[model samples]
Target chain A: AQSVTQLDSQVPVFEEAPVELRCNYSSSVSVYLFWYVQYPNQGLQLLLKYLSGSTLVKGINGFEAEFNKSQTSFHLRKPSVHISDTAEYFCAVSVLLRRFGAGTRLTVKP
Target chain B: DVKVTQSSRYLVKRTGEKVFLECVQDMDHENMFWYRQDPGLGLRLIYFSYDVKMKEKGDIPEGYSVSREKKERFSLILESASTNQTSMYLCASSFFFGAIPGSGPEAFFGQGTRLTVV
Candidate 1:
């Protein structure tokens, strides 16, 4: 069985600032990583995915994540964030099924 | 564009009532899933169906059951709804491309149904 851990429950950042949401997984074998975002009163949307190959994966809205095999971490990062980036972010690991973390709520203040 | 649609956006039900949450996907996907989202729990999978008439229990499947008679529809049933089950229910669908070991399919999610049980 595999599990995902998201260290931060909430992150508050000012507008135009950089942000990083930490994600770690426990799996003995190889794993696929993903980042999903959910806006207020909306469903989850795919932020990005790391299937294979390059560790650095770029996603929609200027967001990206790095997959580190040695540390078993896939952290999402953004150079600059806006007020519209305020939402719930989830980190998931896919083996046979997808397992998600507790999620991190990012609040971008104006 | 892939579209996974839930029957209702919001629902209010009473405890011990039999509740059914309907999900439909238009892309003819081979995989469908049911999940419950809580404040601090993210999205927990309740049930998933890989093909027609084949269902699998997910991480949290204690009080839930699912039906997939048709290929495009997957229904989640709560035989006896409880207050603890009042949460956002989501439906998702994905294509099955015979994934290699450790690689899974990307999912498409619906808008979700907010179920409130009193």
Candidate 2:
């Protein structure tokens, strides 16, 4: 089983500023990490995933995340954020089909 | 493009009614999942089906049951709708070990159906 802990419950950032949402996971075996974003009253959309090879991975909407084995962290970062980027972000970790995470809410301010 | 579709975007059901939530996937994925999202609880897996006529109980499968009669359709049934069961229900589909490798955590999600039990 894998568990995820999002460091921040809510993060408010100014538009065009760099933002980072921290997430850490605990697993005994090899794990897969993912970041998903959800708009108001909408379902989750995949932002990025860290499977293997590169430690750094990029995804849609100018979002990126780094996978650190030792640190067990897969934090999402964006150099410049927009007002439209304000949404609820979730960091999930899974070994099989099951997942674990408390989730984080990112609010981009203008 | 992979698309997952849920039957109703919003549903209103009586407390004792037997509610059925339908889902279909166009990508022919073998794995289908049903989840319910609450304010602070996030997404809790209610049920999952790996293949036709195959179903598995997830973490919180107390009042929910699922059926997969065909390859494309999966349905979730609420035995008895309660206020606690009123939440945003999400359906997702993924290719399990298909041509796409390592797509385990990137399941495509459908526009969740918000259920309100009266």
Candidate 3:
């Protein structure tokens, strides 16, 4: 079985400021990592994924995440955020099945 | 673009009523999943199907059942609707792992149905 942990429950940032949402996972076998974003009243959309090879993965909306095998972490980051970027972010791990973290609510303020 | 569609954006039902939530994917994927989302709980999987007529119970399947008689469509059933079951229901589909050779395991999600049980 695989599981994900998102350290922060909520994060608030001013417009154009940088932010990072931390995530970690536990699994006995190798697994794929993913980040998903959900806008208000909408379903989740894939932000990015890390299958193999590269440890750094870039996603939509100027977001990127780094896969650290040693640390068992996949942290999402963005150099700058817009007000429209306010949403809920989830980190997930998948072997044959995928398990999602609790979620990090990003609130971008003016 | 991949499209996953849910039958309703919002629904209201009385307690003890049987409820059905329908989901369809146009991508012809081999994997489909049903999940419920709530504040602080993220997304908890109810069920998933890897093939036509095949189903698997996920982490939280106690209050729900599922049906997948055909490809591209999966249905989640609440045998007896209750206030505790009121939440956002999401449907997702993806190509089976390595099914498309080089495709990744990324699932496409629907618009979600917000079901309120009274």
Candidate 4:
């Protein structure tokens, strides 16, 4: 069985400031990594996914994540966050099945 | 664009009543999933179907059942609604026709149904 761990539940940052959401996973076999975003009252939208290849993968909305195999982490980062970026983010891991962490609430204050 | 539609956007049900949540996907995807979202907790899977008449229990499938009589429709049944079951239910579909060893399936989500159990 695989499990996803999201260390922080809430992250508060000012607009135009950089932000990072940490995620880690544990699994015996190879796994797939995904980041999903959820706006208020809305369903989950795929932010990005890392299946294989280059460690760094760029996703929509100028958001990107780096897959650090040695550290067992896939953290999401945005150099300059916007007010519109305020939302909830979830980190998930899928090996033969899927598992999700609690979630991180990003508050981009002006 | 992939389209997944739920039967209702909001619903209110009484405790001990049987509740049905319907979902349809137009992409003809082979994999359909039912999940519920709540504050703090992210999406937790209830059930999933890989093919017609085939179903598998997910992490939280204790009080729920599923039906997939057709390729496009998957239904989630709550045998007895409870206050704990009130949540935002989301349905997703993916083209995982042949679940290969390393195949990564990208899911498309529905708008979601906010179910309130009274």
Candidate 4: list runs displaced more than 4 Å: B97-104
lDDT, candidate 3, A59-107, per-residue tens = 9989999999999999999999999999999998988678899999999
Candidate 4, pairs of clashing residues: none
**Model 2 lDDT per residue over A1-110, tens place:** 67788898899999999999999988998877889999998888999988778999999999999999999999999999999998898888867765746678888888
Best-matching candidate per DockQ: 1
Query: Mind giving the per-residue lDDT tens digits that candidate 2 earns over B1-118?
Result: 9999999999999999999999999998988999988876678889888789988888899999999999899999999999999899999998775333223556889999999999
Q: Model 4: per-residue lDDT, tens digit, B1-118?
A: 8899999999999999999999999988888899999888888988888889988888899999999999999999999999999999999888772355212457888989999999
DockQ of each: 0.61, 0.47, 0.55, 0.53
Chain A TM-scores in order: 0.99, 0.96, 0.98, 0.98
Native contact share for candidate 2: 0.37
**Model 1: TM-score for chain B:** 0.95
lDDT of 1 by residue, A1-110 (tens): 99999999999999999999999999998888999999999899999999999999999999999999999999999999999999999999988889999999999999
TM-score ranking from best candidate downward: 1, 3, 4, 2
Cα lDDT of model 1 by residue, B1-118, tens digit: 9999999999999999999999999998888999999999989999999889989988899999999999999999999999999999999988875553212468999999999999
- Writing each residue's lDDT as its tens digit, candidate 4 over A1-110 gives 88899999999999999999999988877778999999988778999998889999899899999999878899999999999999999998987667888999999999
Q: What is the DockQ score, from 0 to 1, of model 4?
A: 0.53
Q: Please give, for residues B1-118, the per-residue lDDT of candidate 3 as tens digits.
A: 9999999999999999999999999999988999999999989988988889888888899989999999989999999999999999999998887643212478899999999999
- Provide the overall lDDT of each model, using Cα atoms, as 2-decimal numbers: 0.93, 0.87, 0.92, 0.89
Give the range where candidate 2 chain B is weakest over 10 consecutive residues by summed lDDT.
B97-106
Candidate 4 local lDDT, residue B96: 76
Q: Ranking under DockQ, best-scoring first? A: 1, 3, 4, 2
TM-score of model 2 (CA atoms): 0.95
lDDT leader: 1
